[model samples]
Target: MIRKGSQILMEVLQEEGVETIFGYPGGVVIDIYDQLAKTDIRHILVRHEQGAVHAADGYARASGKVGVCLVTSGPGATNTVTGIASAYMDSIPLVVITGQVPTHLIGNDAFQEVDIVGITRPCTKHNYLVSSTAELARTVKEAFYLARSGRPGPVLVDIPKDVSNSEAEYRQLKDVKLKSYNPTYQPNIKQLRKVVELIRSAERPVVFAGGGVILSQASQELTEFARKTQIPVTTSLMGLGAFPGSDPLWLGMLGMHGTYRANMSIGACDLLVSIGVRFDDRVTGKTDVFAAQAKIVHIDIDPTSIRKNIPVAIPVVGDCKISLSQLNRLIDEIDLTDVPRKRQDWLGQIERWKGTNPLAYKQCDLIKPQFVVEKLYELTRGEAIITTEVGQNQMWAAQYYHFDRPGHFITSGGLGCMGFGLPAAIGAQVACPDKLVVDIAGDASIQMNIQEMATAVENCLPVKIVILNNNYLGMVRQWQELFYDKRYACTYMNHSPNFVKLAEAYGAVGLKATKPQEVESVLAEGLSLPQPVIMEFEVDKEENVYPMVPAGAPITEMLLA
Candidate 1:
């Protein structure tokens, strides 16, 4: 059957089970938008292109599916760069389609046309510029395939305007075979055996899990393995919910703002079994001294990431779930009667470290950001899907809110992008309408994409925005205070909008808490509301996130709070 390119695009999206897309229409994408309107797929009209991509990213993270977003050419396409980079850094699967000028005007500096494919090359996993309607369906299929496969990341497809208006016979591409790409799902048994041997012999072994554990859905296997081996576990920021936070074996998060026990354990452990982590600079404070005492066994689907940052004693290239499953089976075969006894001294040391400097903040007259996060966690019973913007708010949420399951906590861990939480919350809410979704945002970060409040209001999404209004770029200000000797830079956000009025103006409920006592009531009321809300708490402006490891310092050397 003959079909227009736009029609084929819509049909292929539906075929791929894309029920919702976050996008905006412009001159170049009018035909596509027109066809999209005729279909059953829900389109979220975001105020900005960045918001659209962030929303899609949030949706993908929450739903564990390839997120889809569309935008017009030139500036509209350029605006999505930050969000795309964020997704790329975090390895989020996303298919971003951008409209373009006709094929004839390809290199003539056409209006509403920029070389999007070229612009996004460095960040995107792959990209394409479709010149003909005949290849539209295939390109889309390949884009979706590339986006979701092998260390998932964003893939862009630029569709020329004429192609959408052109006609071609439509046929759904079922089998997509890319000769160059094939992900190893099965782990090498010898390496698994080696890991098991290490587990058996090492007196102090720590299972350091990362976002890849959650991405590969290996939380169950990880939990079981850690429990059976009696190995304490510590996670990267992105790996927050990969293991149960409330578990006795959990060592909380490990990094610059990581817990005292977690960092100390990583520094002192004899064996470090790293699963699905990139070993970013934030996690590994000094390359030379990071996990210096430990023999590292690194397992990741992306072979390039194995030895890219830190040298590994054992590099296992395979999917995280598969590798963990194999390790679990191998572990079951070993003599494990003495595992608990072997780990007793190590666990005792960790307990002492935990007791010595546990995560704590004083309850003062002024509202404390940590206290607000604690109350939110309590009120929601740690059940709410918590998304966070970058900076102090992100750190506080990570420290205070205990996540017991995967996908419960979402944040821009790698890119550390500001203005991510609110739109992400909207996307998460849309993906899971029945679940309570909250964006734990900072006052400054929240304003970055605050326009998305209208998106939530229009969609009737009951996402709650908890703004820790510290009235400054809290993270940077903290650094300036500590390192620069109180040379207060341009970090102060002297003028900001009245958040309550801002929410009300966007047709959503607005609440504020000035005193520390009002924090609980505001949270409770905001959570109880059926509509979208922005609950702002005027928090301590100069408050800082502690357990700091100065740049280039060893992870063990920390400036305590």
Candidate 2:
């Protein structure tokens, strides 16, 4: 008796130590789903295929594991596009499996079929369209390897329906080889020496760390490097948890809506050593003006990412962890002693600015944004893994929530996608069942994937959802308030379903806290429940996340609303 391709896929997954998969089943992928059911691998059925992918992304970000998402072809596969792009922009590792039409109907446009491999090629780190049962094992192995290796991003495997049911030898693919896909992780010592030379000579050297630090598991290395070099550090949104938020040298996220002092630090630096961060448009407003005075040393795992946006003085293409280790080894301990702490005045200025206009909110009768964030921080105490929906809530969480360790915060930083939180929370909870996981979302963004509460309830995953019930697309409304004269068009969500009631209907705990006085109690009650809970807070409708980085403004020119 020969094994089915679907069985082979599961066997490969087991070999890879995959514990869970997030997915939505469809007709074409039923064989694979059936195989999944027989295996010990826990499968989470998401409300939308898109949510499944995003949840997988969250799992990868939180656990540092290769996330797996499965969906059927055509619309089912296509639905995951946004989530795939989000993972791509943030460089998260994901392995996506999509069911295809029968192998025979390759280009005939068969029913319930789309060119998924082609559609996902640009967004995915790599893609495979398994046309024959013979190629199934190899494809699956290659997909996993590609997803988990170097500067990881989403990888796609499109398996045809007939191929899934086809008979083939059950030999596990052990000797998988990809000549073109090998990831070089060693740092160039010569280039690194030049970097050290630059570091020693520069008066003001700032390290602009990005998600790459976490992805490369180089957070400790980064902290050590900063401490040794006596350089102030600033981070991108995705890089928030890579360094201790409370560290004296660490300036918070740098971007539009980034901390004022952090942005100023980025602007004032003479030599900017950016690691594992792609200089996105949001972070580097006008390329010409961003870090204009800084000589950039761009270090990253992906070579293509070097100098794509910002000019680099030294481009070191290697794994950040490996590179930092090499840098640590090469630099003599005594030489670092002479590396002067040249930025005391600079540090003092930044601290003074941070002290004067710290992230603050009024203690009015209404529930404030900071209070909601602070309460969550207090309850969870930097232990719970957090996924944030885009917009003001995301910024607020980034600003107020002190991330004590790396990989504790997951958000759609690169794409800044709105409907990311709930699904991501599901993924985080699945990745680390012991940890408290929270999805902090806006009421407008929460409704986007609120249906995933069913997934949480079904899996018995206790994810606390704190909906900042602002009743509007808070981020866009802020844009309108500042730029468009407050002429809100489609930001209001008066037609949204009652979120607390919606949570109840999904067979999970439901809660509401309309005032600051009720915040602590409702949060306590929500946290006490071992099942999924949705706590809705009626925040000030017109509230805004301060320290706004106006569109296209230089990092130093932030606006406080």
How would you encode candidate 1's per-residue C-alpha lDDT over 135-173 as one tens digit per residue? 999999999998988899999999999999999999878
Q: Give the lDDT of residue 425 in candidate 2.
A: 93
Clashes of each: 0, 1
| Weakest ten-residue segment in model 1 by summed lDDT | 546-555
Every candidate's lDDT: 0.94, 0.87
Error of 2 at 538 (Å): 0.6
Model 2 TM-score on a 0 to 1 scale: 0.97
Candidate 1, superposed: residue stretches over 4 Å from native: none
**lDDT for predicted candidate 2 compared with the true structure:** 0.87
TM-score of every candidate relative to the true structure: 0.99, 0.97
In TM-score terms, candidate 1 sits at 0.99
How many clashing residue pairs are found in candidate 2? 1
**Looking at candidate 2, what is the lDDT of residue 96?**
94
